[model samples]
Target chain A: MQDLGIRVLFMGNNFIRLLGGLWITVKISLISVGLSIVFGLLLGMIMTLKNPIVKCLTKIYLEFIRIMPQLVLLFLVYFGATKSFGLQLSGEVSAVIVFTMWGTAEMGDLVRGALISIPKHQYESGAALGLESRQIYRYIIVPQTLRRLLPLAINLATRMVKTTSLIVLIGVVEVLKVAQQIIEANRYTVPDSALWIYGCVFFLYFIVCWPVSRLAVRMEKKWEN
Target chain B: MEGQEKLLEIHHLHKDYGNGAVLKDVSLDIHKGEVLVLIGPSGCGKSTFLRCMNGLEQIQSGEIRLDGEVITDPKTKWSEVRQKIGMVFQSYELFPHMTVINNILLGPLKVQKKEKKEAEKEAEQLLERVGLLDKKDAYPRQLSGGQKQRVAIVRALIMKPEILLFDEVTAALDPEMVREVLDVMLELAKEGSTMVIVTHEMQFARAVADRIVFLDGGEVVEMAAPEQFFTQPETERAKRFLDTLSFE
Candidate 1:
C-alpha cells in the first residue's frame, strides 16, 4: 500500500513483453508435448516387446535419460553439439530438443506402466475373441490404457509447462527471463520492483498451471465412477 | 460320436514353460456336436490342453488340425482360425470399458466385418438367450459375477464358432450363481454344440459331457463316457481322482 512498485509493470510495454515471453514458453511446451506423445507411444510399445535385444536397448535409453540432468542435456545440445559436432542449433531449437527428449522418456515410461497394468487375461480374451494383435490394441488395450493414462499425462503436461522456465538459462527469452530483465531495468527507478516482478511471474505460472491441474482432477473423479 | 466328423484333431501335443513340461504327449479329438469335458487334478494341464486347442498356448511340438487345416503350423493365421474356436475363461474377461452389447458385437463387426445392424440384432438375440438382453447397456463392472459370466458366454456365442472352449468357466462363480451359467452350457449341449470344457464340477460334468477325458500328471489317464468314467473308472489314477471328488 505504501510503495508497492507495481506501476513499473504498467509502464510502456513491459506487460506485453511478459505475454510474448509466455507465448514462447507455451509454444515450446506444446510442440515438445505433441512430439513426446506420438514418439512416447511408440517407445512405450517397443519397451513392452518380448525381444531381449529390444528390451535391453530401450532399457539403456530410458536409464540414460533418467540419469542425466535436464540442464546438462540443454547445455550439451546447445553448447556442446555446436562446438564439437558443428551443428548450428538455435537456443530455442536446443531447448525444444532437450525438453522433448526428457519428456518422451518420462512419458514413454508412463505408457509402459499403463500398458503393463492391464491384466494378462484382457489380451487373452481379446485374442480368443478373434481380434488381431493390432485390433486388440485398437479396440481393447488402447482404450483402457488411455483411461488410465490421461490424468497422469495431464500432470506431466503441467510439469512440462513449469519446466519450460528452465529454457531461460539457454537464453531462449521465456517468461522468467523477461521478468528478470524487467526487474533489472527498473532496479534504480523502482528499487523494490524485484519482489513485485517475481511475484507477477509466479502468478503467471499459476494461472497457466492451476486450471490444468484442476482438469486432471476433474477427469480422474469423473472416470472413477 | 466316434463316426461323426471330427471338428478338431490333436496329435502328440507337448507344452512346457522352459523349466518343465505342463502338457506331455497329450492327444485328443473333438467330434462335431459333442461336448467333451476334461477333468484332472489342479495343475495337471487340463486348462493348458483346452488353451492349446484354440492356440492360446503354443505347444512345443504338436499338430492341431481344425477341420483338416493344420492350425498348429507356424504360418497359420491363428486369428482367422480363432474366429471358429471361441473360448470362455475362468474369469469373465469382459471388456470393462464397454457395455454388454458392444462387447458382444466387437468380434462380429471388427473381425468378421459384418453389417452393424445385423450384428447388433444377433447380439441382442444371444443376450436374450442368456437372459441378459435387459443388461445390454450395462458396463461389465456393474454386473454380478454370474451376470458377467453370462455376458462372457454371450460374447463367445455370437461368434458362432465351430467349437467353443470353456476353461473352467464357472469355477469362479458362487454356488448359487454357478447353476445359471451351467444351465446355459447344458442347453447348448442339448442343442448339439461342439464344446471342450475344463471344469472341477463333477456333477455338471457328468450331466453335460458326451465323453469325459480324465487327465492326471499331464497325461490322459482315461477317456470314457461319463457313466463309465464316473462309475467304474478303468485306471487306478482315475479311481483315485474320482475318490477325491467324492470326499469333497
Candidate 2:
C-alpha cells in the first residue's frame, strides 16, 4: 500500500469538485429553510387557533412529521411515491421537500411555544387599548411572538444545514457523496486517502454550521439581556 | 341636571361565570367629566364590570349605554365602542418587542388609521405628558414597571378615547413607583378625561374620584361621593372592608 501524502489534501480539481458539491448542499438547505419558515408560521398559527377542529388537525400534522424519520420521508418522496403513484421527483427536489417538511414541523412547534408563552394579560391589554382582534394581533401579539421565535428558528436553520448530509443517501451528489467518490477513485493509489477526504467533509460542515450556531447563541443572549 | 349629557349608563348589568354569578343586576350612571372609582374586596366584580363597559367581558344580560348608544344591544358595533373606551390593565402589557414610541403609536396608526406623522406627533406629546419622552426609543423590557405602565397609559390615550378604564393600574408597581403612575392618572383626571378606575388606593380614590363605588360579592353595595364614602360609609360591609385595608 502506497503512503497517502498530504499533497492530496488540496488537489486543484478535487477542491473544485468538492466546492461544487458543497454549493448544492447549501442551495438545498436554503430553499428548504425558506419554505419551512413560511409553512411553519402558518401551521403554527393554525395550531394555536381557538377552534378545536383546526387545532386538532395541526396537532395531527405535527405528530406525523415528528414520528416519521426524515430519511424514510426522503425515500418515500424520492423512491416510493415515484413507483407507487407514477410520480417523478428529482433527487434534489425530494431532498428539499423532505427537509422542509421536517423543519416545518419543528418550526411550527417553536412558534406555538412562543405564541403561548406570552402572558395572558397582553391580550387583555390589547383588547383594553380599544384594538380590534386583527389589530391586536398585528400590533401586539405577532411582534412579541416573532421576537421569542428568532433564536429557536436560527438554531433550526443550523440543524437543517447539518441534516443536509442525509440527502446524499438519495443519490444527491452533495459534498459527502463527492468526497466518497474522490476517496474511492484514489484508494488504489493512496490507501488512506478516504480518511483525510472524510475529515475535510467534516470540517466543511463544521465551518458552515459553527457561525450559525454562534449567531443563535448571540441572539439568545441579546434577547435575554 | 336633566338637560346635561350622560356619558355612561348601565342598566341591570348581569355577568356570570359558570354557575356562579360575578355581577348581578348592577345598574349605575356616570355623568360627563366624572371620575368613578370602583373599590371592592377580591372576587367582587369591579374589574369584571370595567371589562363589561368595553365589551371585553360579555354580560350575560342587561344593557350598557355609552353616549346615548346602547353598547350591549345586539345591533351595537363592539369595535366602535372599544375604540371610544380605552382600558389599561394592571400588568401594563406593553408590547415587549416594540419601543415605547411604537407602542404608543400602534393604536392610533393601526386602529384609527391616522397618518404616520400625525400619530408620531401625538405619541411624542403623550409620551412627554407621561414623562417618558426620553425613553421613547427603549423597548418595554428596558423600562421599569412604572415606566411600562405609564407607556401603556400613554398608548391608550393616543387614541383619544372618550373614557379611559383603569383596571387597578397601580396594583402592579413598587411602593415608590405607584405614586408616579397615580400622579399621571391624577393629571389625566384633572384634564377632564372621564375615567372608571378599579383600585385599592383609597388615598387616590379620595383625592381624584368624584364618586366612589363599593362592590361586594359581585353586587354594588354602596355608591356615594368620595367625601361621604370615606367619611360615613353607610354599609357594614364597606366599613369592614375599610378596616381590613391599611389605607394610610
Candidate 3:
C-alpha cells in the first residue's frame, strides 16, 4: 500500500494531467463569465426601466435564479433537460449554460444596485445642463455606474472561477475530476492519497483566486481614497 | 428701451402638487440682459418657478415663453429649449466621476455637438472665466463647495445659453464660499447674459438685481425695481419679510 509513496505528488505525468484538466476549467469559466457580463448588463438595463412589463419580467428571471441552487441548476441542464427534451449537450456545454445563467442573474442585480445607488440629483443636473436622455447616460450615468460596478463584477468573476470545480461532478474531467482519478488509481499503493490530492486541488484554486481578491481590495482602497 | 426685447415671459403660471397649488397664477416679464432675482421665505415656490422656466417642472395650466416662442407647449422640444436656458442647481450637481474639464465639456460636446478639441478649448476659456483653470483636471470630490458650484456654472455656460437660471446656487455653500459663487454670477451679469436667480441673499439681490420679485404662499406679492420694492414695498408681506432680514 506504501509502494507509490508521496513521490507521486511530484511525478511529471500527474502534473501534466492536472494542468490539462485545469485548462478545461479555465476555458469554461472564461466563456461563462463573458456571456454572463453581456447578458447581465442588458437585463440590468431592462430592469431599471420605468415600464411595468419590463420590470416584472426582470424580477421573475432574477428571483427564479436566486431561489434555485446552482448545483440543482447544473443537474437540470446536464441531465434532466438532455433526457426530457431529447437534448444532446456535452458536460462542458452544460456547465457553461448553467453557470452563465447563475452568473448573469447575480451580475444583473449588482448592476441594478450600482445604477440605482447614484443620487437622483445627478440625473436632474444632467437635465439642467440641457442633456438629452441618451446624452445623460453617455456623459453622466454610465461612467459613475461603471466605477461602482467594477469591483463587484471582479468578485463575481472570481466566484465563477471557484465554482468551476463543481462541473467535475457532472463528469467534465476538470481539475477536481483529474485529482479524483489520480487518487483512485493509487488508492492501494498510496494510503491517504485522496487527502493530499484534495489539498493540492485547494492550493490550485487558491492560486487562481488570490490575485483576483488582491486586485479587488486594491481597487476598493484606491477608489475610496 | 425700444431696442431691448423681452427674453422671458411667465403668464398666469399655475403649478399644483396633488391637492394644493405650489405656484398660483404668477406672471412676470424679464427683459434682455437684465438680472431678475426672486427672493422669498422657504416653500414660497421660487425654486419651482425657476424649474418651470427650464422645463424641469411641468405647470398645471399656464404659458411660459422664451424669446417669443412658447416653451411650455407640450409639443415644444424641451432639449431645444434647454439648450438656450442653462440652469445651475442649488446642490452644485457636478458629475462626480468626471474631472472639472470633462464636466464642463460634456454639455458642449453632447447638446451643442462640438468636436472634442473645440469643446476642450471652449471649456478652458470658461474655466478661466470662473477662476478655475488651474483645477481643470481635478474631480468634483477634490474641489470645495464654492469651486464645485463654479465648475457647475462653467458646465452650464459651455452650452452657450442665452439665459442662465440660478436656483439658489449659493444656498448650499458656506458663508465664506457664498461670495465667491455670487461674484462669478455678478461677473456673468456684467457680461450682459440675461439671468434669473432665486436667492436668500438679500444684500446681493439688492446690490445687483434690476428687478426683484417677492413671492409668498405660492403667489407673487410684489414685482418692482429694487429701489422702490425695498423702500416702499407696496405689500405688507414684502415689508414684513424685509424687516425680518434687516436685523441680520
Pairs of residues clashing in candidate 2: none
All candidates' chain B TM-scores are: 0.98, 0.96, 0.97
- On DockQ, the leading prediction is 1
The 0-to-1 C-alpha lDDT of every candidate, in the order given, reads 0.91, 0.87, 0.88
Per-residue CA lDDT of model 1 for B153-203, tens digit only, reads 888988899999999988898888999999999999999999999999999
* lDDT measured at residue A36 in model 3 versus the true structure, 0 to 100: 95
Give fnat for candidate 1: 0.85
Error of 3 at A83 (Å): 6.4
Clashing pairs in 3: A1-A189
TM-scores of the candidates in the order shown: 0.90, 0.88, 0.89
lDDT of 2 by residue, B88-148 (tens): 8888688777788888887777777899998898888888878889999998888899998
1 or 3, greater by DockQ? 1
Model 3 DockQ class: medium
Chain A TM-score compared with the true chain A, each model in order? 0.94, 0.92, 0.92
Candidate 1: C-alpha lDDT: 0.91
lDDT minimum window of 10 residues, candidate 3 chain A? A1-10
List native contact recovery per candidate, as a fraction of 1: 0.85, 0.70, 0.70
DockQ of each: 0.64, 0.57, 0.56
Model 2 vs. true fold: TM: 0.88
List the candidate numbers ranked by lDDT, top first. 1, 3, 2
